[model samples]
Target: MARILAEISRTFGEYLLLPNLTDERCTPGNIDLSAPLVRHRVGELAPIRVATPLVSAIMGAVSSVELAIALAQAGGISFIHQNQPISEQAGMVAAVKRHKAGFRHNDVNIKPSATLDEADTLFKRTGSDVIVVTDDGNPSGTFLGLITTQDFNFIRHRRDEVVDSRMRTARELVTGAEGMSLAEANSLLWDSRQDVLPVVSADGRVTALVHRRDEALHHKFSNETVDAAKRFRVGAGVNTHDYLERIPALVEAGADVLCLDSSDGYSVWQQNVLAFVRKEYGDAVRIGAGNVVDGRGFRFLADAGADFVKVGIGGGSICITRDQKGIGRGQASALAEVVAERDAYAEETGMYVPLCSDGGIIHDSHMAIALAFGADFLMLGRYFARFDESPTNKVKLAGQVVKEYWGEGSSRARNVARYGQGKDLAFEEGVDGYVPYAGSLYDNVTVTLAKLRSTMISCGAISLRQFHDTARLVQVSQQTFVQNSEEVQRNERPTVA
Candidate 1:
């Protein structure tokens, strides 16, 4: 016989937080959003810590290399999706690892002897107006010169004309020595009145380009996530079926961490995958697992050696698993249950395994509520899919610009391994959809984080730990929720003219 739990499943919308007495020290400026990303001793710092408690979901539409770079720069992380071929996914991981702060690598390069048409092709392919001409046209070749769109026009120059005829000769360009600090490079750029300063090695090879605009944008990323080598930190998603082949490739490509991408993760297959990772890499690799919804599921993954346990099943914005299979707990209920287990486990073993609330985050308030309930971080799909940094194409629909969003279980993604429903996806567990387009990630995240900081301030908490220790919440009835909305609508109504 199936057992029934006594507690009713409750979502984030059913709860409200009560404000605590504001202390003089509890200000938005004092609030620190840093949180652990992996398991660690009770008193020791986690090996990996995200500057912010936000991570983009491991979905095809959300976790592109571009989005991963932007989020890491913004103090968060994005797990590159694993739905593609192993080599392709590994390449994405490599691209993020190769990204340097305030420096552009030689993706924009051409041979000095190349024709103008060839140079133009390279410029358009890289989306860079300024092209660095090298002896051999490779990133490591000897520096030759630089060319820009302003140097030549179709009417003035023939397509077959060699690039050397129009490029600014190396003698004319101001070059910085290798290992020049960003501050020093910026100083030279402004003082010399140059649009860019190419950093060169002793062998006279152009290593990287320091752009004037990149310098201005660099200052905004004080909390960017980075590895020991100073490269931006990024995560990759792996699957049980491809673990043998995918894990090594991603690790070789410099993925800082990996997650087992799945819709439901409380199975022996997951344990087998964990065992394999442990046997192969030991503690040298950090991997997270799950979409578990309760204490039992959380304990299962934790015992199997997951560095972090993701909580929530069928709670994503695009998910239809609950409707298709009726097999999911409400996100709030699931998170609360797993948190209780995490606390108990910590008490028993003195090892605190971080809990990631994976879905059902509709409002900024839900983020705060999840934190108060002991979620170490939040994983979002729809929230990130609406941003400009996401990989989805922007299309006009119903007079509004929107971006595509879909679930891994949807026919569109056909991620059978994530669902573990056999050789193929037996039925649709997710849906394809669109979200209203939001502007740049920097702008949207700034406002969202501001609201989160304000919420913490109002609760008189200056840190995530303090917020968890002192927070209070009350369940709201449907009538009260309706009344609250009505009051807001009334307040928003305009006064009579």
Candidate 2:
């Protein structure tokens, strides 16, 4: 008398169908258990890769420190949004790094006025393609002009009269506000018809230069050879109002990749935002757009000439979209259908549109399926919510204890973000919100990532990208969810981080 199937994984948020994972079947170790992740290169930088193939949505302030850090540390990247002051975003990013030592200089910047020779030397010596340009007149340290090594070639060979003569003025070059989303930047770049962009500060100072590079940094997803790195590449999500208004803050803050942020990305405001980016900023920076799941939104974004499209309705732990709106696609089903059609579109036009599967990947297998189904990058939101280092969670939240945390799209977030202009939280709690107490961030990140790495090794893949290509996936119905319950619950690790 065996009940063929009974309820299983229900206790652990019905989002997951199967949760029983043992080291043996889960992963190997230190091997390439991934796929050829980075694709669609725009220029010099490596095609972008989200650690978890997921990201925290730019939901106002809700994608607080806990959420963003937990996702990033767990191998997913989170976009810090305009939920609050510019300073808060910086602090949040700082906190995302599991350890201080792993972060490259977050604020690494250089002057655009340095020289064409300087530009060449920097690239040749350090092999770096990105640089921050500063101006004395601009408080944000952006400039009206910039000179790249490519432009510098003419100056170096004496083809131009001087560096100043060969320079592309900020007006002539593409420019994305530091505050804009990556999608906005890409859209602007495409419309501007320029390859290079100067990210300017609030005062219009050229803080850094963002540009699209070449094929090495890109890969073909399905058929169309869209440049993943070039398109999905994003800038730091600054917590501010008026995306353009935050540009100066972003430039000063050292964000070159722009991720145009919005909860529902298919709206007129979002489209107009990208259009404005395309018209005003032109083609200075690569753009990334999303937090969308259906083809309508995807098609809309592509029709808008978005270089890359983000796919996902609601997959985050803290997300209440389904509950609030009663709309969403199961992540796997969404990715499978969308990716297949997207690939077909690519085959027909030779213009591949990349998809970032942005949610509901609770396990490593989900990551593989996302890539196989045709997602270029995965942006996990809640998985990274509990990290110890994220700025959003300075303190812990518990009944007896209190920690710092916020919701990206919460009413509280809207209120807290309006500080300084007599609009900021003058009423509802001046200080940031806190969560019930949680434990250390490092402990959670280290163990989880190690397992992910080991999982990758078992697959015999060198990287996450390869895992997509090599790993095979099968979809299971609710029955799988039922049988795996007790084991998953029993083995379910402590709910910390």
How many steric overlaps are in each model, in order? 0, 106
- Candidate 2: segments with Cα more than 4 A from true spot: 1-78, 85-234, 238-241, 363-372, 392-406, 415-443, 456-465, 487-497
Question: Mind giving the per-residue lDDT tens digits that candidate 2 earns over 433-477?
Answer: 544444554355445546656555555555655555565554555
At residue 412, candidate 1 shows an lDDT of 97
Global lDDT scores for all candidate models:
0.89, 0.50
Badly placed stretches (over 4 Å) of model 1 are 108-173, 193-196, 202-204, 211-218, 487-497
Tens digit per residue, CA lDDT, model 1, 83-135: 99999999999988887776666667788889999988876554467998889
TM-score of 1: 0.89
TM-score of each: 0.89, 0.53
